[model samples]
Target: MQVLFGYNTNGGQSVQSYGYYDPNYANDIRTVMVAVVAQSHVQTPQQDAPTKLQLIPAVPASQSITGESLPAVYFYPPAGSHNAQFTVMTTTVPVMNMIWH
Candidate 1:
Protein backbone atom coordinates (compact mmCIF):
# COMPACT_ATOMS: atom_id res chain seq x y z
CA MET A 1 0.00 0.00 0.00
CA GLN A 2 1.17 3.55 -0.74
CA VAL A 3 0.12 6.90 0.66
CA LEU A 4 -1.64 9.00 -1.97
CA PHE A 5 -3.60 11.75 -0.21
CA GLY A 6 -3.50 13.91 2.92
CA TYR A 7 -5.69 16.74 4.31
CA ASN A 8 -5.87 18.93 7.39
CA THR A 9 -7.42 22.03 8.99
CA ASN A 10 -5.97 25.12 10.70
CA GLY A 11 -7.07 24.03 14.19
CA GLY A 12 -8.35 21.01 16.08
CA GLN A 13 -11.89 22.23 15.44
CA SER A 14 -11.93 20.29 12.18
CA VAL A 15 -11.09 16.83 10.94
CA GLN A 16 -7.97 15.43 9.20
CA SER A 17 -7.52 12.39 6.99
CA TYR A 18 -4.97 10.36 5.00
CA GLY A 19 -5.50 8.01 2.08
CA TYR A 20 -3.58 4.96 0.86
CA TYR A 21 -3.47 3.69 -2.66
CA ASP A 22 -2.50 0.32 -4.02
CA PRO A 23 0.18 -0.56 -6.56
CA ASN A 24 -2.38 -2.02 -8.94
CA TYR A 25 -3.77 1.11 -10.56
CA ALA A 26 -5.77 -0.80 -13.13
CA ASN A 27 -8.09 -2.44 -10.59
CA ASP A 28 -9.72 -1.48 -7.32
CA ILE A 29 -8.03 -2.18 -3.97
CA ARG A 30 -9.55 -2.69 -0.57
CA THR A 31 -8.23 -0.89 2.51
CA VAL A 32 -9.32 0.27 5.94
CA MET A 33 -9.55 3.98 6.95
CA VAL A 34 -9.81 5.48 10.39
CA ALA A 35 -10.07 8.89 12.11
CA VAL A 36 -9.66 10.13 15.69
CA VAL A 37 -11.07 13.33 17.20
CA ALA A 38 -10.16 15.13 20.41
CA GLN A 39 -11.70 18.04 22.27
CA SER A 40 -10.63 20.07 25.31
CA HIS A 41 -12.52 20.64 28.51
CA VAL A 42 -12.73 23.83 30.57
CA GLN A 43 -13.71 24.28 34.19
CA THR A 44 -15.86 27.23 35.12
CA PRO A 45 -18.09 28.34 37.97
CA GLN A 46 -21.87 28.04 37.64
CA GLN A 47 -22.28 31.80 37.51
CA ASP A 48 -19.76 32.09 34.66
CA ALA A 49 -21.22 29.25 32.58
CA PRO A 50 -24.08 31.32 31.21
CA THR A 51 -21.89 34.24 30.17
CA LYS A 52 -19.17 31.99 28.73
CA LEU A 53 -21.60 30.09 26.51
CA GLN A 54 -21.47 32.80 23.89
CA LEU A 55 -17.68 32.43 23.63
CA ILE A 56 -18.10 29.06 21.92
CA PRO A 57 -19.38 29.09 18.36
CA ALA A 58 -20.62 26.41 16.05
CA VAL A 59 -18.10 25.35 13.43
CA PRO A 60 -18.80 25.24 9.73
CA ALA A 61 -18.43 21.99 7.82
CA SER A 62 -16.48 21.21 4.64
CA GLN A 63 -16.08 18.45 2.07
CA SER A 64 -13.34 17.04 -0.17
CA ILE A 65 -13.06 14.75 -3.19
CA THR A 66 -9.79 13.39 -4.51
CA GLY A 67 -10.98 12.46 -7.98
CA GLU A 68 -14.12 12.47 -10.09
CA SER A 69 -14.78 8.75 -9.56
CA LEU A 70 -14.11 9.09 -5.86
CA PRO A 71 -16.65 9.77 -3.12
CA ALA A 72 -16.92 13.03 -1.25
CA VAL A 73 -15.57 13.30 2.29
CA TYR A 74 -17.45 15.50 4.71
CA PHE A 75 -15.75 17.32 7.58
CA TYR A 76 -17.71 18.23 10.69
CA PRO A 77 -15.83 20.73 12.73
CA PRO A 78 -14.53 19.73 16.18
CA ALA A 79 -15.29 16.01 15.74
CA GLY A 80 -13.71 13.79 13.12
CA SER A 81 -14.98 10.84 11.11
CA HIS A 82 -13.66 8.38 8.49
CA ASN A 83 -14.86 6.54 5.41
CA ALA A 84 -13.56 4.32 2.61
CA GLN A 85 -12.93 5.80 -0.84
CA PHE A 86 -12.12 4.09 -4.15
CA THR A 87 -9.89 5.94 -6.63
CA VAL A 88 -8.23 5.27 -9.94
CA MET A 89 -4.52 5.92 -10.26
CA THR A 90 -4.27 5.29 -13.98
CA THR A 91 -3.93 8.12 -16.49
CA THR A 92 -5.54 8.40 -19.86
CA VAL A 93 -3.44 8.25 -22.99
CA PRO A 94 -2.74 11.68 -24.49
CA VAL A 95 -2.12 12.39 -28.15
CA MET A 96 0.43 15.09 -27.35
CA ASN A 97 1.06 13.97 -23.75
CA MET A 98 -0.63 17.13 -22.47
CA ILE A 99 -3.95 18.41 -21.09
CA TRP A 100 -5.65 21.78 -21.63
CA HIS A 101 -8.35 22.37 -19.04
Candidate 2:
Protein backbone atom coordinates (compact mmCIF):
# COMPACT_ATOMS: atom_id res chain seq x y z
CA MET A 1 0.00 0.00 0.00
CA GLN A 2 1.11 3.58 -0.56
CA VAL A 3 2.74 5.24 2.46
CA LEU A 4 0.89 8.47 1.97
CA PHE A 5 -0.90 8.06 5.30
CA GLY A 6 0.37 9.29 8.68
CA TYR A 7 -0.68 9.29 12.35
CA ASN A 8 -0.34 11.25 15.60
CA THR A 9 -1.48 8.49 17.92
CA ASN A 10 -0.60 8.17 21.57
CA GLY A 11 -2.12 7.23 24.91
CA GLY A 12 -4.98 9.71 25.23
CA GLN A 13 -6.03 10.98 21.80
CA SER A 14 -5.38 8.45 19.07
CA VAL A 15 -5.47 10.01 15.64
CA GLN A 16 -5.03 8.27 12.28
CA SER A 17 -4.55 10.02 8.99
CA TYR A 18 -4.31 8.73 5.43
CA GLY A 19 -3.02 10.15 2.17
CA TYR A 20 -5.17 10.11 -0.92
CA TYR A 21 -7.66 12.30 -2.71
CA ASP A 22 -8.41 15.32 -0.54
CA PRO A 23 -11.85 15.90 0.96
CA ASN A 24 -12.09 19.47 -0.29
CA TYR A 25 -12.52 17.92 -3.69
CA ALA A 26 -15.50 16.12 -2.29
CA ASN A 27 -17.54 18.96 -3.78
CA ASP A 28 -15.48 19.49 -6.89
CA ILE A 29 -17.97 19.53 -9.76
CA ARG A 30 -15.52 18.19 -12.30
CA THR A 31 -13.99 15.68 -9.92
CA VAL A 32 -13.80 12.14 -11.24
CA MET A 33 -12.84 9.65 -8.47
CA VAL A 34 -10.88 8.93 -5.27
CA ALA A 35 -9.53 5.80 -3.56
CA VAL A 36 -7.42 4.75 -0.53
CA VAL A 37 -6.93 1.72 1.68
CA ALA A 38 -6.44 1.43 5.43
CA GLN A 39 -2.94 0.29 6.19
CA SER A 40 -3.22 0.12 10.01
CA HIS A 41 -5.67 0.43 12.87
CA VAL A 42 -5.54 1.25 16.57
CA GLN A 43 -7.69 -0.52 19.12
CA THR A 44 -10.87 1.28 20.08
CA PRO A 45 -11.30 2.84 23.49
CA GLN A 46 -13.68 0.95 25.76
CA GLN A 47 -15.55 4.15 26.63
CA ASP A 48 -16.09 5.73 23.23
CA ALA A 49 -18.80 4.64 20.84
CA PRO A 50 -17.81 3.77 17.24
CA THR A 51 -19.65 6.62 15.67
CA LYS A 52 -19.49 7.33 11.91
CA LEU A 53 -16.26 9.26 12.23
CA GLN A 54 -13.90 9.40 9.28
CA LEU A 55 -10.25 10.19 8.53
CA ILE A 56 -10.91 12.97 6.08
CA PRO A 57 -7.92 13.90 3.93
CA ALA A 58 -6.89 17.51 4.07
CA VAL A 59 -7.57 19.77 1.10
CA PRO A 60 -5.05 19.33 -1.67
CA ALA A 61 -2.26 21.88 -1.56
CA SER A 62 -2.64 22.69 -5.28
CA GLN A 63 -5.58 20.40 -6.15
CA SER A 64 -3.20 18.43 -8.29
CA ILE A 65 -4.37 14.87 -8.94
CA THR A 66 -1.12 13.92 -10.60
CA GLY A 67 2.49 13.65 -9.34
CA GLU A 68 2.12 15.35 -5.91
CA SER A 69 0.58 13.48 -2.95
CA LEU A 70 -2.42 14.16 -0.77
CA PRO A 71 -2.22 13.57 2.96
CA ALA A 72 -5.07 12.42 5.16
CA VAL A 73 -6.10 14.22 8.35
CA TYR A 74 -7.83 12.70 11.34
CA PHE A 75 -10.80 14.40 12.94
CA TYR A 76 -12.47 12.90 15.97
CA PRO A 77 -14.91 14.46 18.41
CA PRO A 78 -13.72 13.05 21.75
CA ALA A 79 -12.43 9.74 22.98
CA GLY A 80 -14.71 10.11 26.00
CA SER A 81 -12.97 7.67 28.35
CA HIS A 82 -10.88 5.27 26.35
CA ASN A 83 -8.93 5.74 23.12
CA ALA A 84 -10.29 4.69 19.73
CA GLN A 85 -7.98 4.64 16.74
CA PHE A 86 -8.46 3.57 13.14
CA THR A 87 -6.76 3.81 9.76
CA VAL A 88 -8.34 4.98 6.55
CA MET A 89 -9.17 2.41 3.95
CA THR A 90 -10.26 2.86 0.35
CA THR A 91 -12.07 6.20 -0.06
CA THR A 92 -13.50 6.74 -3.52
CA VAL A 93 -16.80 7.30 -5.29
CA PRO A 94 -17.10 4.67 -7.99
CA VAL A 95 -20.81 5.26 -8.41
CA MET A 96 -20.16 8.97 -8.65
CA ASN A 97 -17.75 8.32 -11.44
CA MET A 98 -20.43 6.48 -13.37
CA ILE A 99 -22.62 9.54 -13.19
CA TRP A 100 -19.80 11.68 -14.48
CA HIS A 101 -19.57 9.52 -17.55
After superposition, the stretches of candidate 2 with alpha carbons farther than 4 Å from their true spots are: 1-54, 64-73, 85-87, 96-98
Instruction: Please write out the lDDT profile of model 1 over residues 1-101, one tens digit for every residue.
Output: 11223233232222243233433321222222333333235433332222111211222233222323333333333222122222223222212212111
Please state the error at residue 84 of candidate 1 in Å: 27
Per-residue lDDT over 1-101 for candidate 2, one digit per residue giving the tens place of the 0 to 100 score: 22232222221122223234355433322322243333224555564544434455454544433334455544344544234544446443222333223
In TM-score terms, candidate 1 sits at 0.19
Least accurate stretch of 10 residues (summed lDDT) in model 1? Answer: 48-57
Q: CA lDDT, every prediction? A: 0.27, 0.37
lDDT of 1: 0.27
Clashing pairs in 2: 18-72, 36-89, 36-90, 36-91, 38-89, 45-83
Model 1 lDDT at residue 77:
32
**Leading candidate by lDDT:** 2
* Residue pairs in candidate 1 whose N, alpha carbon or C atoms collide under 3 angstroms: 13-78
